[model samples]
Target chain A: MIKANKIEKTYSKTAILTPVLNDITLSIQKGEYVAIMGTSGSGKSTLMYILGCLDKPTKGELELDGVDVYGMDDDALSALRNKKIGFVFQQFFLLERTTALDNVLLPLIYANKYPDDALQRGRKVLAQVGLEDRVEYLANELSGGQQQRVAIARALINDPDVIFADEPTGNLDSQSTAEILDILGHLHQEGRTIIIVTHDRTVANHAQRILELKDGRIAEIKNP
Target chain B: MTRTIRIARESVRMMGRNKFRVFIMMLGIAVGVASLTLMMCVSKGAYERVMDTVNRQGPDLLQIRPGTDIQTGLPSGSREVVSLIEEDVSAILQHVGNIRAAAPVKDRKEIEVIYEDKFTLTRIFGVIPVWAQIRDFGPREGEFISEEDISFAARMCLIGQTVKKNLFGDLEPIGRTIRINNVPFTIKGELQWKGISSAGRDRDNRIVIPITTYTRRLFRDMHLTQIVITVEDTKKLNKTIKDVRTVLRDQHKITSGEPDDFAMRTPQDLIDLAYGTSRSLINLLTGIAAVSLLVAGIVIMNVMLASIAARKSEIGIRRAVGARKNDILKQFLIEGLIVSLFGGLMGMFLGMGGSVILSSLDVTASKITPLAIAAAILTCGLIAVVFGIFPAKKAANQNPIDTLKV
Candidate 1:
């Protein structure tokens, strides 16, 4: 479950304020599959970031699973993200020169639980992403598609309640993109809330609901 | 606790990745610690060496020599005149309660010694029979001069290594006759091989004869060249010195406020003087070594700053994965500690090796103490922590969102 009330974000430079998000309010029930779709500068990624508790909003109330995340300190916010939300980035954001298994173990480092069993869980998650054979390969040794799979495995390692994937297919071939989309669809079916931020209409089609953002505000919500 | 280990393991892996850069940084610290250790080794070793020589002779021995004017401390102009006599020595030995033995000595430099065709010029010293035990110069072969030799003014003497080498030329000089200043004397014994003194003087280049023989047959004067006083108790040396001065002053007929015509030096005095000189030398060397550590610290800081700049993305990724600011700080700090600690250990070994080589070469009597090694390591660790803070703080405070944008 996630909620936002009139969320606003702005960047200030040399006494000039530029708003990135304005008066956007939304909510999603538990285990719902949703997509935030927009072109560049449409604030769709910003909204997703705020909802994932990675960045704070200038004006709004944000709640994740009945907890007021905005009121928590940096440590508490990080703990919430480690437990309740996982992120997949456009660049994959996997640590270079690190093994796939170790990358998958990243979230567990901050999860503050099951330290001894983290390796076993990381191996299981890598296997779930069909990367068990490639778990020992470094990020630099993997294909773009395989790297994205490793990032996905890392996201799944914590078993978070929600997943935020930003342009997950932006740098992939059509075949790899389809593979990633199928994984997302399967995860959604498993009753985990999914929010994908992307500009591709085809990518948005995999979700049950699509919220189109324009000019830093939510312009329309369509069920497909 | 396991998490902490994970973080340390990651840091070690990171350092491994940057092998060349890390080695250069560690080398800088290593040189600094090495210099620190070497300096301490040299000074401490030299100090121990001097004390060893002093203790070997006798800790309570005092040597008195005539100098200057009887009433003034100022030196009487050239062509020196001796004022101390056998009477002054006997007075100190009688009236000075703590004096165990006071042997009056008479010595002359450039005395020609000849054994058949072999000949050389050396110092000839005359002392009472008891002086042999007091100076720790008792003959290692044959025998020292006897009381019978002193009273009879017999032509018997003990030769040192240098004099033996020049006059005897590998021949057994004991029981052999040698001519000193054209006067024939039988060699009764040979002295031990005493090394050079701290003042850089040869210690085994003289021959000893009885004082009675020296006064009657050579100089024919009662005035003594020096007085070697051995105290009954070493702890009471200061009191003995004061009493000796009182007796000497009364014998020489000097009044209050008048400077004595003689100077006195004890084994303790030599030790204090040696320590004072070595301390200054050590301080100067230590100061120079400390500067090296400071320079290494600066170099480490620069390297760490560049590393922080290069790892921005890595920092962002770790932050995204739940690494707190303190975690990042600790990682870098631990990285610094690892480098410095290893460098310090390597430096200690290098320093110890260097000191051994130096001691062998006779450049310095150098040795490394355990405390010095521990201290050198601790200093390097502290230096790392001190210099690492700035870069570690910068790494910890970076904006993860901005870093990710890169």
Candidate 2:
């Protein structure tokens, strides 16, 4: 479960204040698959970032599983991000010049919990993303679609409770996009909560419910 | 993998990514450490050499030389002033408690000697029979001078290797006669070949004659230039020195607080002086080398800072995964230590090789010790930590959100 109360994010430039996200409240139940749809400058990406714990909200009271995340320090927040949440950026932010298996193993490395079967765990995650044969391929050597799958496998390495995907299929072909959606649907069927932020209508259609954002505010919610 | 091993592995991987830069940084540290190590070797080698030479003269040996201010007991002013007299030698032998043997020495340099058709310039030492026992020198063949030779002012002398080579060539010179200052003297024996003395001066290039013969036949002077004393017991050296000084002061009729115009030096004193001189020389050279090491440390810092800049994206990715700021800090610091340690090891080999080459050339003695190498490596590690912390801290403090955005 996730909750945000009156979240606000602002950027200051030369003594001028600019608000990227205005006061808004939202909550999502466990196992819910939701999509936030917005055009450029609509603050959907900003909301996703705050919810993913990548950045703190300027004014907010965010709670995850009844724990106040904003009240914790940077180290504790990083640990929470490691064990609970996974993120996939639009650009497939996998480490370049490294093998896909190593990319997936990144979270395990930082978590300092390399089980005796850590390598096997990494391999299994890559297999789930349909990259079992490309585990040893470097990011640069892989196709765009393959790289995105590798990034997804990395996000799933920690077995997070919630997956946050920001335009996961933005740079993929239609065939690759369908494959990614099928993987997401399978993950959602496993009872894991999923949230997707995208400007593409077809991508939003894959979610169980949709929320439309406009000008830094949530305008409408629909079950589609 | 263990946390430390993982961090070290990552650090090594980063260095491998920038091999040329790492190499340059290591070269800088190596040169600095090499020079420092070389300085230590040279100083140690020179000190040991001097100790060897001084020890040859025996440990409890003492020499009383003129114009060495009695106040400080050090050589002072002009040594041309011969203040010690023959009476001081006799008085010291009589009054000193730990007396072994005493000899009065008078020497003149560049003295011309002629033998048949050959002639050469050499030093002449006029000493009593006891001088042989006091200075650790005796006839290599035949015999040294005797009291009878001094009592009658006998025209008998002992020739050193150099003197014998010049005056007799291959012929035996034991009974040969040579003229010194137009006076005839027979060579009673040949002194041994003692290669070189302090300061690389020839040790076997002089002739020894009786003190009476020297004063009566050659340069007529009653004042002795030096009084060589050998103490019987090592523990009584100081007491013997004080007793000798007391006799000389009393013979000169000087009251308390007046300079004795003479100074006593033991072999240990010379050893200390030699060691101090070498230590200062080593310090000066090492100080110069340390400046370059400081520059190298700065260069390491600059390279690490540049690396942080170049790896911003990687840093952000790691942070997003779960790495804390402390992890980033530790990674960079370990990288610095690895670089410095490698450089230091190479530098140690470089310095050791240099010392070996230098020693072989016989320019100056050089010795490498294990302790010095360890010290140099430890210093390199310290330099790495000192210079590596700033950039590492900067990297650690970088905000993940900002870095990710970029």
Candidate 3:
């Protein structure tokens, strides 16, 4: 479902060039649940970003479902992300004043062809995440776990092929983390590819495969 | 179309994020539009009032006054000018092509007249019978001074409304005798109410007598203060004016290139003279409209910039969710437009309501025209597009990664 070949990422500030990711290569099959584990400054998040099509690699080939992901233009890449990738960040990034249902419907708004039953689909997704009762509650009014669920519902509204959760449980309580991980696991079981980024070994153990990164390169891969 | 509606809905949602920010943005446009509408209404009303005043003097009417060729200024406190005379009036009346009627006038300002041991100071004008029709002032009751009165130099007169009130005081004015400079003249008519003139002087505080009697018995001169002429076709007034000037110069024996000792005016010239005195007030109104709109534009732009600065992360979130740069641009631009449109509508009502209130209070003449309404509305849209661009650009050009970092 995904392939990366010799991926490299470098950030330049004036004359100084800082390498973040160096000669990284990896692949994950369809329906696989993978976790990228690293400590601070391990470049695990950078690798996830490149793989998720949110950031372009400095020098690399990335293929998702046989398409050259990095070869597309900015608008095409945005459309690709809208159609193929779902993201759950630690911040939630939901519009604070909007309702949970509205938050879930956001990505669908940017869809090239909006579905006529968009509102119905949005409600269904919110129901799937057990947020049906809180559909009318504003994002700020919801608890941390509830807000993350709303974010997940947003990520799932477009029915994307891959879900990227970057430290998704970092801001949540333990119970909320278990609930969110269970939802991610359920999404993977439903034949969607899930790539999770975390420094917690226990979180990595929940995945079918774990890729460990050290100093900008993949240090080890543990198969399920 | 659905996408457009979705984005428009998003823009509205963006506006509702901060009520204070939206209000701040609206204030300038509202105030600007209100002042602009008011200025236009005042200007339109002032113009209409000027035309009414000028039309009262008669659009086809022309005046040749004794002077050294100045176009404006009332020839008051006169009898010094000997250049314009009865013979010039006769020549112009006979020779001018479009002349419908003509009358010679001689006036003395602030003259005291007596009635039955009571006296009031008023202006005295001596004119022929045709002056009534040519100048549009005639008897409201009784008969005007006739040609027999002029030819026979009869001691006959017409008393104006103010004169009747002051000198006669509810008594029958017609057939009564009043003394001008101690000379007696029988009242032939009671003239209509003339009201105050554009110069703010009481127009009805004057009396009229036969020009023959004026020259023969009153001011004792063949010299005329002015000659009033009405034309058959007002559209040919310019050609008629040229003809009158030529006839007057010929009668006065003035050569070409030598300035005639007379001034001439049409209703247009009178309107210009009236507006000249009020030009400063008009300019001040215009300046208010301009400055307020400019301030409004600046305030709107700055407030939008500040609002964008506060909503930077919101823009980043929109971008991360797959909104293109153009989507961000269209969103913010529509937000500005919506706010400005609301403000403009509010101001339109305010300005029109203000004009009605002002007119009702007699503060100033004011008229509301559709053009003013259209201008106010279209200007709001234009302001949004003009002032909304830079801030929207700044929002669209922001780096999403940096904004979403935390």
Question: Could you give the CAPRI-style class of model 1?
Answer: acceptable
- Which parts of model 3 are misplaced by more than 4 Å? A5-25, A37-47, A56-60, A113-120, A199-202, A211-220, B68-73, B91-99, B231-260, B276-278
Taking the tens digit of each residue's C-alpha lDDT, what string does model 3 give over A169-220?
Answer: 9899999999999999889889989999999898888899999998888965
Q: Give Cα-based local distance difference scores for all models.
A: 0.84, 0.84, 0.86
Over 4 Å off, model 2? A8-24, A37-49, A57-59, A167-186, A199-205, A209-220, B57-64, B67-80, B90-102, B115-117, B169-177, B229-284
Give candidate 3's error at residue B252 in angstroms. 5.0
C-alpha RMSD by candidate, in order: 4.2, 4.2, 3.1
Steric clash pairs (candidate 3): none
For model 3, residues B1-406, the per-residue Cα lDDT tens digits are 4777889999998788788888988888988889888878877877888899888888888888887656545654445667877788778867778789988898888888999889999888898888999888999999888989988999998989999999878898888999998899899898989898877788899999988898789877667888899999988988898899888889988999998888888888888876764466567768987888888888989998988877777786777778877888889899999989998888888889887886787767789999889999999899999999988888887766656667
lDDT tens digits by residue: candidate 2, B36-87: 7888788779878777877786777888878765433232335378678888
For candidate 3, what's the RMSD? Answer: 3.1
Question: What DockQ number belongs to candidate 1?
Answer: 0.42
